[model samples]
Target: MMATIVKGGSFVIDSSSWESIMTPEDLSEEQTLIAEAAEHFIENEVLPHDGELEKLDYKLTVQLIRKAGELGLLGVDVPEKYGGLGLDKVSSTLISEKLAKGSSFALSVGAHVGIGTLPIVFFGTPEQKRKYLPDLADGSKIAAYCLTEPSSGSDALGARATAKLSDDRTHYVLNGAKQFITNAGFADVFIVYAKIDGKHFSAFIVERTMEGVSIGPEEKKMGIKGSSTCPLILDQVKVPVDNLLGEPGKGHVIAFNILNIGRFKLGAGCVGAAKDAISLSAAYANERTQFGKPISSFPLIGEKLADMNIATFVLESMVYRTAGLIDAVLQNIDHGSDAAGVQSAKGIAEYALECSINKVFGTEALDFVADEGVQIHGGYGFIQEYKIERIYRDSRINRIFEGTNEINRLLITGTLLKKAMKGELPLMEHAQSVQESMLEPTEQSDTDERFAQEKRLLATAKQIFLLVGGQAVQTYGLELEEQQEVLARLSDMMIAIYAMESALLRAEKITAKSGEKRGELASIMTSVYVHDTFASIERAAKQSVAAMASGDLLSLQLSVLRKWTRHTPPDTIRLKRQVAEKVKAAERYVVV
Candidate 1:
């Protein structure tokens, strides 16, 4: 075993004690317009047809997507030059989230617009763009990305499907299959990746009209059943020479780059779904009575509601932050340049940690929030007629499809560490201040005691990230093959910490100008969040450290476990009421 040793003296100031910069802001004018427009389309078009869609009416689903296109929702991310609305990444995310209020319909629409069509829009040649993008942007044609094989779920690049190049190399004969493909049953254009020459991979724009292309019966799923998912079969599917996307032997780039965009969009969708779930939970809690009173009146139920709101708030902030970062990168790419934003890769790469972090944290957070929503409802949550049940079911796939949380965890931790090792992060001035205040902690505010612990854990985590992340890159050569899981965990923790910090920071701002009530909520929530995060981060750090260290592994594990237990704080049933009331008053998830 090659044990990696990291010097412990490399210090990052535990600045989590400082106020956070992450918080959910009101949508900008354009974002509000886009969100409302999407909401209107979903309410008017999708909700009314739920009965038809439940029967697996493909025609109805197709019609609805077309209507979405007509409303310009489909083209939200496309440029105006290509018949799209030419919206930025934030707009797309906002639209996706708002549409998610419609549940499965939101997913169906997201699938058609995001994974189905974005690759061609971003990486396609002008002729290719002219050929496919217009239909995709107009929602006249549906799209799908075929990369997952039965044997290769998250290991997409290791797909077994093969495509053979002809003797003239003018065209390729594709022979392979893609399984569990979203929108497989109805997509007009398929972005299929296959191994060529037995080693290199290539991407092709395979159409449904192709001679040897077919879709198997839809696979029954736990949720999102209304959105078609099935196997895409290619039996000697003869693809045209011009159908090739990007260069030969470079399909991995196309697959991964597009996937990066897909994951980010998927994160946006989760944020939307999370918001919807919280809304549903709050409404249900406010109405449904138990023990002769509205369930929302109970402290435990109130806490659950508060948790749901806070989790959603975290997701929204992180999703938009990621959108802002990705937008800056995509916009900086000169349209006239043939470089295809390769030089601007650092922009996306800079947030790779954030993207995967959001993917894991946001999805899992929503899952927990939704589950609690169902729990609070008691029996109605499980009934088929209730939307919460469907939302719960639909939410399950979000964590699984867009790179399982397991895979995402690795990417998150690995990316954070790698970035640190590469010295890409500019160092902030190191400082620490401890102030003892008797002020009660608020719902989203950080208590000094709790904040201090988080600061220490984050500082240590950054060190571990650099140590393990640097060694992994050096040994494994930056593909993140072996170090993915560790990276993912690290990334998840970072996102949670970031979200918690953001909420706390925002609460502080509100409290400073406002009265004690707001400040109290902020302080209490902050205490709970910061302390909880401190414990979680410490656990993850200890695990990663143990994985890299050469000491008595069992002893290290027990020490970390004991450390966590010793630091854990008492349960806050009282503090939760403050969080619940604020969220209820706002009628949605408000940062404070």
Candidate 2:
């Protein structure tokens, strides 16, 4: 396998080695302790208040966030010099995953710890970090991210929010209404994005106490009602020149990079929520009875539970794998440096492609799990009395958060193409190689080695991705960028390649360290998910090919596709039943 420095978006072109990647089984003593502490915080301090939290009680939400600060949960990413633990990226991601058990409270804390405070943590000047980080790290203050305006949702740069230099250059007058600002109700500080002189994009630290800073009433929502969502009104607010974040025109850098982090953490939160859904559903299935026995005894019910476990297992593998990659990059940064914030953002920007994929896949996966959970609960699932009902509603917002799944899907393919154009990834070269190799005779694999079959299919999936992507580019050339349908189908293929490979690496690594029996469950889960997802990969490839060509050209492409997808799929039914048994026994999503 080709192994070197792991570049962002390189998975599409290069083979991945499990040796350098992190799996759930690789958690360190310290990282495990961090996970336990976060779990305890969510269980003890956060969950007990769900009744009040569900009532839209902003005061209690503030108190709960403050408690998280006291527990040192808020400061994992903050440097120790600034009253934070400054834990590695894995620890922070672990914290995000664990806190998600509390539903709406997770959103509140996620917004604060992620987008809210990260701007200063990553891009703020020294004086700014010294002045603001201590409280943010400790949860004495809450932060909100202000970017989405009423009219500018996806087109963030088209913001009408304006800031101007005051006479004597003492302060900048800021004016704009930011819509859907999370944690806005009680956020003590805001990381506000506005245009300087209505042209230069920039970010500012706007304190709630500052004159002309006001928050609108919370908008009623479909779910996560406990989390605060409101509009931020900045009317002639006076912000000192020193409070500007990063450079004036480079605000887009801070905004976009911070979003990459947000997208990743959001994926982490979704993983936690999915596990909760599975556990709750499993418990219900075991206890609920119908047709003379427990629902858990029925094959159909077991099938649903099996599907959820498989999806979540793959998503969890990908999330932890990405966190490990970021941690590798973060190890090289010196948090004491003035440019540490900028350095942190730059290091994370490399994995923007993975982060977006995680966001898109993890969210949709959670939504699927949540919906299935509700169905398993029957009529009770729809009623408010059941927690799964809340979980189902809360899951819907994730697809729209960070960036809408639609927008992220486009970015996923767009980012890869841009990288290829800039020569950051060898995508075109790999595509060219795969095309030439297709002209050679096909080879069959009958090796008895462990995971040999899974590896072969994974390799074929990657080739299919590159093939379809190359054809789309050649057919459309510069215009391919505008073909959203083709771009989206190609994005689905890219996603399957990453998901399949991530699951395989984790499974193979686990089996290598532990005995085959100990790692058996993981191996089976990987096989099932890979087999199912590979079929999806084929469908996406053929769909795009049909759209791109016709006649003999289409037939030729179809022949190539058949050669790529000719591997025998494993017996998924048997594998899924095995997975369901383990999940049922544990009453939760499980991997050996």
Candidate 3:
């Protein structure tokens, strides 16, 4: 395992090497094979039954989940002693990504393998693991994540669900409702969160057969319709004392840390779904003719495909790179030890900012691609007869899933500021450095380098973030948390910086490994994304600065922003056209 060279939330101020980060291009043969197997399974088994699953066939969903377990797909993250393969984060991530090609079936498996089963794998005790992990691993028992309640979607701590110790002291009676529970229809096991005695937030392993446990009717949803989503009604459900996950009052720790991990997998799944949309649209573009030529041949259609391709390419890079960060920390831990749960949760929590960033960016990017896919398919895209229609519908829930994009956005900046305050990341110091550097003479960058233009632009974007962020700090001080607008805009800038750097570093790595000629596509995609992203960051920074201050104060900030945003963007039209040619030729996301 590579030692963690960049601390969590430190990428904003840290300089990283192209070779230090991992990319899809760096996947080992074993990891690649596992991903391929998952892809094969999705194509052969799940997609073939799309119609049945779409009809909300609960039995088929159960059977398919077991089939996934039979392949050891469900156990990739589980420890070996407990009947799991205990693979690294990369393999599990790839499996998550690949399963997404099967549409909403991916949601069922994702809910099962990720939020459903992982809490036990990571936090359950020896007896808990011995009893539950094997059944979960073998698919004999299905799992569901029950966190969101009707009243408290984003504010998890605001949960009204209550748990009280039974008079016999042998069990706890759980009484509450968990809403939008994925796999609730058929899950044998549920990881439920409720307030202990209506006060302390806690997690519990609730069995399906527990007395007074019942599932509400499946929701009539906008997307991911195949995935069973129902309300879990806990009416005096008696859960054994041993089933309390982690600790009595430390459930928030378990819940938030598990959410970070869920965000990671959610990001990967979005990437896979986006790829499927791209391929489907590309194929349709070639087959559908308009005025004596294929729509794929039209520049307008090509442009949409190119933009979609670049966004997904960068999102893919961000996901795998973040996975590498998680794996590096997870590598040395002894999974069998009692402290493994705490240790693993800490490891996963380290990258909470990136996880949220991925969740927001990946989902939004997939939504854009799915929308374009339908557009490219023309009228057919809207009809149920076309797969893109379902893809479009499924894409909407992602923004709201894991956490709403709005919540994740707030968390992204909220976590960053909290890190700054705690001295975990040198964000304030970094911002100060940027402030001081503005007075110094700017150094001219070498324009002859492999990606001189893009490197300069990315650097400027970071500086812009630092400058604006520093000003916000100087103005707001401790009260900045209430400035949601400013903080959210800061998050936008941070997201831009992260995505641009991820793509740029990945392109650089590819160039170094495969020669400049062979790495042109990667480089081109990086350049295009960085150009567009930098423009977006410029606006976000200015908007943030304006919102924080007005009149002369805003002018001073705007001047600094103008200085940083002065770099000319690459010719995106030509670059994107070249990108379109490659994607149109391949009819898929070939950058992988």
| Superposition error at 474 for model 1 (Å) | 12
**Highest-scoring model, lDDT:** 2
Q: State model 2's lDDT.
A: 0.91
User: Between the candidate structures 1 and 2, which one is better when assessed by lDDT?
Assistant: 2
What is the C-alpha lDDT profile of model 1 across 1-592, one tens digit per residue?
2212111112232333222232335347888788888888878878888867866678888888898888899997665667787676778888878787776667777777876777776677778877888899888999888989989988888888888888888778999889988788788999999988667788889999999999999998888878888999999888988998878888887776666667777877888777777777888788887779887778788888888876676567567756755666567566544344343343465566566667777778878988998998789999988888988988888788778878777665555455456664432112111111112231233356534554444444454334334444444565656665556555655665666555555555556556556566666666566666666766665666566555575465445335333444646666667788876666566555
lDDT of 3 by residue, 212-276 (tens): 99999999999888889999999999999999998888888888888899988999999999999
Which residue segments of model 1 deviate by more than 4 Å? Answer: 1-26, 335-346, 420-489, 505-527, 544-571, 584-588
**Cα distance off (Å), candidate 2, residue 536:** 0.5
- Decide which is better by TM-score, 1 or 3: 3
Q: Per-residue lDDT for 319 in model 1?
A: 76
Off by over 4 Å in 3: 443-445
